[model samples]
Target: MAVALLVALTAWAFIFYVNMIDEVHDSIDDGLDNSKLLIIHQANLDSTVLAKQSFDEGNYAIRKIEGHHALNHYDVYKDTLMYMENEDDLEPVRLLTTVFEASENEFYQLKVISSMVEEDDLIEDLFYSLLWLYLILIVTILAINTVVLRSMWKPFFKFLNHLSEFKLGKNEQVQLLKSNVAEFKLLNKVIADVLESNIRSFHNQKQLIENASHELQTPLAIALNKLQLLAENPELSEEVVNEVFQTIETLQRLTRLNKSLLLLSKIENKQFLNEETIDFNDLIKSLLLDFKELIEFKELEVIFKKEDDLKVKMNPELARILITNLIKNAIRHNFNKGKIELLITNSSFQISNSGSDKELDSTKVFQRFQKESTDQSSTGLGLAIAKSIVDISGYRIEYAYSNSMHQFTVKFD
Candidate 1:
């Protein structure tokens, strides 16, 4: 609005200045023309009027010129500087030059001067005046804009504040104050509909996951228990016992996979909202204790280096899962007697393990079921779950392979 006003006022000022200059010149020229006619009339009535050669007391002068010189001559009005004895300085004045026929074959040239109007001074004064006017108009506009726009947009800003506080599937609801504005009222309605739709979808997804958890795990558990009992029976043949044990193992892996998939779904649905400041240094130490037996069985050389206490604020369960999965991955994929390096810093947690000689596909490492290892027991959801947790927590995780080691780094902001 301010920019538009400036452009409009500038154009108006230029046009007004031009028109005012034209009007001033027109008024002065009209007066000079009338004076010229009256002087010519007097000169015709009395010859003495034509005898004046210079402007001594009057504002006009007459001088005779040859007929050929006056032929086809047009009256001209122009600005010129003339000496004024009263001011004792050169003053700007308007002059009119015209040719008049005094008698047959006789022509007199007349020059008439107008009272001085210093156009430079006029332009300077007009510039200052217009400048002040533009300033006043802008200030007034800004004042009105502050008061009126603030009042007009109060409901919109308040609505946004409430909307920001609203979370899907949470106890809190977006509570907006009544507004007189039609657009704001419509906005409130649309937002309410969208939130209701999302809340419904969230509840449906949550219920489905819960149902799958109960319905699937119960049968898997019963089958595994019966298989283990069959393996315990002395009547069973060696081959049958081995087969039963294998079946139990497969069912166990399936159970783990189901749990992983359900967890991934929950993470994607933004179900975990609880958060706390988690110290990675302490978390990693605690998790490493749980993986000590496996690490030792692999005969891995573990190198733990801590430069600082790495800390981040996120859901405690998810944070534990993220670190645990990475640690398990590092130990599981590592070759027997290979090296594993764990580094902690103020803002990052990194773990690198010696695994395949060839690098894994970085693009597919974080994707579900994209396993890089030959281990059939691997469910391939460890890295995917870690990645999901990092995403929800607003952290970043990256994969890189260098010096025949697979490295996963989780960076916190």
Candidate 2:
């Protein structure tokens, strides 16, 4: 807008300056033409006036000329410089030379001079005036627009501020502000409806997961107890005991799956809001002690190196679960006599373990029930739960495979 304004003002200033200069010249020329006529009349009335060949006292001079010199001659006006006796400096003047008849067959060349205007001074003054006008116009326009736009969008800014403060599933109500604009009013209504629907669905889904997990726990516990009793019976044959143990294992897997789903739901709902500083180095050390027997059973080479203590502020329970899941995932998918590497730094915790030579699907690695290995005992929710915990805590988790090792790195905020 400023650029366009500048272009328009410049074109106008140019045209105005040209016309003003032309008007000034025209006014000066008119005065000179009137003076020429008066001087010719005086030369005819007084012969001494025509005898003067140069201007000595007045601004006019008349000289006698031959008839041929006056032939085909036209009146001419031009600019010239003349020395001022009083100021002792050259001053600009206008000259009008014309041939006029003092008597019959007697021609006189009349030269009339007048003070000329200083065009350089005029141009400078005009440029300054136009510059000030441009600046004043820009400032006035910006001031008016600032006030107008602020008032115009007041309701929109208010609506956005209110919307930003809303949280879903917290039972907090959304407060929609009134707006005069039709579009903002419609937007407010539609967004309020969508948020209400989402909150309703969230509560329903949360209730269903909690109720299902709770209802299944009692029967699963009873079934597991009965299966364990059958396996312990002395009268049972070896094949029957094996089948019962398999059934118990399957039921336990189901139980783990149920618990995992509940945990994931809680994480996504941000239920674990309690936070405290946790030292990851100590957590990893305790977890490794708890899994010592399993590590020995697989004959896995364990290497734990603590370059620095990793301290992060997060939910203690979530921190424990996040690290535990990664450890279990590493052990569960590892090959016999494989190597497990744990490296803890000030900002991150990494676990790398030897597994299948082929890389797991990175895109689906953290998805629910994405089994990448042939471990039938695996529930396949370990990595998914870990990912959910990390997301809720605003931490970062990454997976990479190199040198036949499946590596999981969790970086703390």
Candidate 3:
């Protein structure tokens, strides 16, 4: 917009300058004609043939000739030499003339020529002055506009700073100070609404998890105790014992599934605040040890590799749960005598396991209730819990399958 205004102003200045030059030329022509008339009247050259010689030599033209007491044959001297010659677009030289009889058989011809070159020079100077004046004005206006725009956007920067400091689910409320601009006020209102809705949803989900966990705990405990007593009966037949063990396994799977679901819900709600510096290599080694029995039971070759002592600040319980689930899934989904490779680096950890070449949709792998294999004991909450933990920790989790290998990678800052 500023550039456009400047262009228009410049064009107007050019046109005005040209008109000024034309007016100056016309004034100069008129002044010259008046001076010629004054010289003829003062010197008394009326009715003299010598005046004709002087006029011809002066480059003035005779426009008309008039007789005494007659309107015709008026000998008029018109100065055409001083008219503008270089400008082709201007009209050709023109002057008005008339013969006046001073006495009987005596007459003086008067001519008027427009000559205003001095005025043209003044107009030229004015044009340059106005051009420079407008240039300075435009520069000043631009500088002022930049400063004003920066001041108007100050509230937006403040709002961004406040948002940057916000922590999801942890902050109970977001307050934005009022701004002078209506657009900024509207933006703040929208952000506040979204934050409020998210906080409400988080608290509601947390309450549901708490209630469900508490209500189911007593019944699950009683059932487990009754099953334990039944399995210990002395008179139980072999088939009855086998059947009881299967029922017990099914009950245990349900209990684990419930616990995993509750843990995932809590992680999503950001319920825990126990954050400490944890050694990543140590955490992986400990989790692998817990899964040693499962690895042996599946007849899988488990290899753990790492760089020593990669430390990060996170909740220890969440970290343990994440790694345990990942390793458990790897062991459960592997083929007999398959290899499970756990590799830990400074910024990331990878778990790759031997599996079938059948492709799994990696995009949906982290979604809850998504399972890659049909293991009866597998809860399908393992990867989902890992994903939630990674999100809360500001880490990245990805899955890839190639060369008959399923790989899970967790990247940390």
Candidate 4:
């Protein structure tokens, strides 16, 4: 914008300067013509006497004279032309003459000369003054614009700084101070609405999780205890005992799934206290060791690699729950002879499994209530739990599929 304004101003100044010069040129031409006519008239009255007197007074200097035609020089005085080659400090001027017969035996010769210094100086002064005035005007306009723009944008800058410092999950309410501008006031109102909606949604979801967990606890415990009594009965047949054991396994899966869901909700609510230094590498290795029996039972190959002691400050319980769900999910989804690999580094931890489940859409796998298969024992809450942990801990989780392998990577920075 500034550049465009300067270009426009420069173009306008150039056009005005040119027009001013043309006016001065025309005025000089008219003056010179008029002066020549007057001098010729005066000389016609008495050419010899006036010529000789002009020469003596150095007002007219004759270069050459013929009967009625002569070539002379004129020195331009205040508003009149005089013939002088070396008078005062003025420059010498030359003129052309032609004799014309006004009547029989009567003739007149005219000389014309013009000085352009005064006219040139007038045009130069006008252009320089205009140029300086234009510069001052542009500078004044720019200064006013800077102050106005900064004043108008002050509220926006304050709003942005306030928003940046807000912690979403931790802070239940956000307040914005009133602003002078109408636009800023409207913007603040919109932000307040959004923050309110988020808080309401979070509380509603948290209440649902807690309510569901509490309602399922009593029934699940009673069912497990009943199944245990049936399995321990001495008179029970082998087939019946086997059936009871199957029921207990299904019940156990439900209990574990419910617990995981509740934990995920808590994490989302920012209920987990993160106040301890934890070695993430050590946590992953320990989880793998604990799951050795299950890994062996499935006849799965386990590969573990550790690059560095990755340390982070977080809730130990939440961190353990996060890693446990990831490892369990990998083991459960693997093929009979498939391999489950865990790679740990300073910045990231990755779990890869050699299994193909085309029905699984890797992109939506982390969404709550999304199940990869119709296995009744699978709660479809593992990845959701992992995502909650990742979000609360300020980490990132991503899934990828390549060469018939499924990989889940968590990065911490």
Error at 258, model 4, angstroms = 3.6
Could you estimate the TM-score for every candidate? 0.92, 0.68, 0.69, 0.63
Reference-based lDDT, each prediction: 0.89, 0.86, 0.75, 0.75
Q: What's each prediction's clash count? A: 0, 0, 15, 3
lDDT of 3 by residue, 263-363 (tens): 98788778866689989787888777887787888899988888745788899998888888888888888898999988888888889999777767888
TM-score ranking, best first: 1, 3, 2, 4
Ranking, lDDT, top scorer first: 1, 2, 3, 4
Q: What shift in Å separates residue 100 of candidate 3 from its native position after superposition?
A: 18
Top-lDDT candidate index: 1
For candidate 4, what is the lDDT? 0.75
Write the residue-wise lDDT of candidate 2 on 41-91 in tens digits. 887788888877887799988887899999978999888998888878888
Off by over 4 Å in 2: 1-166, 170-191, 229-238, 269-276
| Model 1 stretches astray by more than 4 angstroms | 65-71, 118-124
What's the distance in Å from true for residue 120, model 3?
Answer: 5.5
Which regions of candidate 4 deviate over 4 angstroms?
Answer: 1-144, 151-155, 173-178, 226-248, 260-278, 296-302, 309-319, 335-339, 355-376, 387-406
Error of 4 at 65 (Å): 25
